[model samples]
Target: MGNLSRKKKKNKKEKQKEKTKNNLIDLQMDQENEKIQKTIKIITLGTGESGKSTFLKQLSILYSTGFEESSRELYASTIQKNLIHYIKILLRAAHSLGIKMQEENIRLSRSFFAFDDLTTQSLQAIIQLWSDPGLKEAYERRSEFQLPDMSKYFLDDAERIGKSDYLPTDQDILNCRIPTTGVNELNIVVDDLPWVVVDVGGQRSERRKWIHHFDGVTLVVYVVALSEYDQRLFEDQTVNRMLESLDLFAKTINNECFENKNCVVLFNKDDIFRKKIKEIPLKTCFPNFTGENDYQSTCKFIQEKFDKIGRNKKRVIFYHFTCATDTESMRAVFDVVSSTILQNQLNVGGYL
Candidate 1:
């Protein structure tokens, strides 16, 4: 009787929590539909490495539900890998600081950047570009950095003071807008609020473009990786750079016009943080950590951040998802977006 009662109580509490969550969703939906047939556009604004691509991929799959696993696998193995490699080398060059690629390290290092997704890149944002495979980093193309003992030194560690393939130190800071489609799953009614997904590239110059594509973005999904926190300890400026970029993007928009724009700051992976549950709520582990449970935590944190900044945080909502394209992750990308659309009713009117 005691065990049954405790289980029943726990379940009862959980049910109550769920009821509250449903109420919030219904409220948001009602407000969203105040102006009937509102055409909500979902612009997926995010940076190159922020998992916007992955989210879109998931969304695509969800909308195209019932696709054969083989077809999805083929897609992931081909176009996805190509696109990923293209992005990785660009960074390896910058951070390697002109290190010559050791034949051995070249293959291994290349593998790390190969998978190329938000979670992977967030943990180690590809910082440098790789050199030609056969040639050593000390191999000359205008030849300034030459280490004497090739065996003693790691080829990648050599100085890149005068490398020819420099992307230049004077690149402009403009966020790149990656326009994507394949959102066949959700209804037009669900996506009523116009969405402009801004993909803020990590490099400073790349963030400038994020503002150009916000035609009618109603929500912002902040994809923070648990792995990134472990790697950077929030000490690295990578997270701040991302946040600052968002802040700047916000500044570009006319506050009066986009005032109702909702922000859903999603904490992407709880599966990665099983060990740190006691330290603090996964959402609040950093400076402005929020509470637990993906949806409520996200909404609370968004609300709190906006309140702190004197903006209408009430309009913002949040959620966490442990989504991956693989089979075992047991979660789908489109499902997250679908739930988000349902709960936030992002297309709802300017004001309830």
Candidate 2:
């Protein structure tokens, strides 16, 4: 009887030990799952010149180290080239508009375009040509033709940019226009959460590559340029830019692959939009819109168009007005973005 009693106690103890071992294994797995949940994967999507790359640059400035010296040199070179290209566009537009330049200025423009490289003499000519009433007149009608929205900002700083030792400032870097080609990935840790951000080219030709990145996307950040309402597509001038953006957004937001993903629609270029709205009516692009042309009403009108498209989707969405070149504004905007993402995780885990 004693032997039997001892065996029973031993078996009970062994069973308890086995249960504890199982519990530890379960706990470890739970911890690991929690860690995995903390990582956020984001993909930025938009039409060409819609401020996608600028948003990525802001992320780097905010979360990671800023650009290195060599990178700045490259941007500086691009900026110089951009300056020359912008002026040439203005000159051509001026000619088309029947705005005459002085004989000397015309000669300067012709010679300036022929130079294979940017030089001090060319910079002086640019400064002189920019002051011409005819060029300024053509610039006012820029909506009739394609030009980067940052043209005036950079042009106004012509003297500073023309210096031989000019280095692009952080603001300059943010405003610079560089088309993203294939795919660029940035890994940043924000608020103790690992973040993987992927930026793809927004051009129509580069959109085919976007499908591969869609598989594991945790969030889709659809950016739109509010100022594009008065512009046309560079690829196909016959099509209005804002209309193109809306069509693209509708397809992207309602995509079957993203039915379960969260999305954020950023009506970007608010600075330019605010100014343009006063001059051009919102109805130009959205003819169906009946709201007031003021900033608040116009912005809401545009947002509703996007909201209507995603109303039936199974995922949550957030919207914000953003000026990607403004770091302070972006800081506040992204804070909300991060909170929304975290809250979503809580809801998924039934912790809310």
Candidate 3:
């Protein structure tokens, strides 16, 4: 009888161990399932230089540990590339406006076209062109042409960027403009929920690829440069940039695939707009706008222009005036956006 009792005790202990092991497995599986369920997919849409990439960079900076050392190094090369790009833009603008370049400046422009890649020496040559009185005059008339807002930024930093050991600071990298050629994605956990933020090229050529990403998106963050109200597209000078953005926003919201998705319309570049609003009338592009020259009234009028696009749509549209480079401001806006998304999701699930 003693031996039988001892055997029973051993079996009971083994059974308890197996039960705990199974429970742990079940717990881990539940955790994995929860992660998958909580994953939110967000896609950013806008015209080129509309702050889509900037917004993603802001997210990575605020939420993640910030960019890695290697990524910062990459921007050094990007900054150089941006200088070359800016020069090309200036050359094109000069050619279009029939502005004559000095012989030296002409030679410098030809040298850039000569090399497929930019060497340090070649970049220095470009920087020299910036000091040319003729080139400076042409750049002054850049507004007549469709140059990017960051043209001055790149031109101003040319000499530093031409150095062999120059490194881009966080702010430099943020302000540096690079046209996205394809879809770029960042996976970040914001407010404890996993998020996959997608940024695509915002140029007209890039718009065709956007439809491919529309299916699984949880939210669409549409960025429009508020300052672009006075600008024209680089690709097509005839079409106003702000009008193009308005049309794109309308098409995105009206799409059946994203009819249920939420949208956040960011009228970015509030800082630039604040500086130019008084000088450049809102009615310049939007003739129907009758608002005052103040920032509040101007932004309200701009918001209404965008709002009118989605008036018939069922999807909720939220508008914000944002300066994408401002981390503190963006952080606050992102918090509100995330909260709205969460609440809306819960309401959809009958949890609110």
Best by TM-score: 2
lDDT of each: 0.41, 0.88, 0.82
Clashes of 2: 0
Report how far residue 204 has shifted in candidate 1, in Å.
3.9
lDDT per residue (tens digit) for residues 37-62 in model 1: 34444554433344455454444333
All candidates in order of lDDT, best leading: 2, 3, 1
TM-score of each: 0.41, 0.88, 0.80
Model 2 scores what on Cα lDDT?
A: 0.88
Candidate 3: clashing pairs of residues: none
lDDT of 2 by residue, 40-71 (tens): 78999999999999999999999999899999
Error of 3 at 39 (Å): 1.5
lDDT of 3 by residue, 57-139 (tens): 99989888677889878988877777777777777777777878788788778767665446877777777877767667777
Clashes of each: 50, 0, 0
Question: 73, model 3: CA deviation in Å?
Answer: 2.7
Candidate 1 lDDT at 168 equals: 15
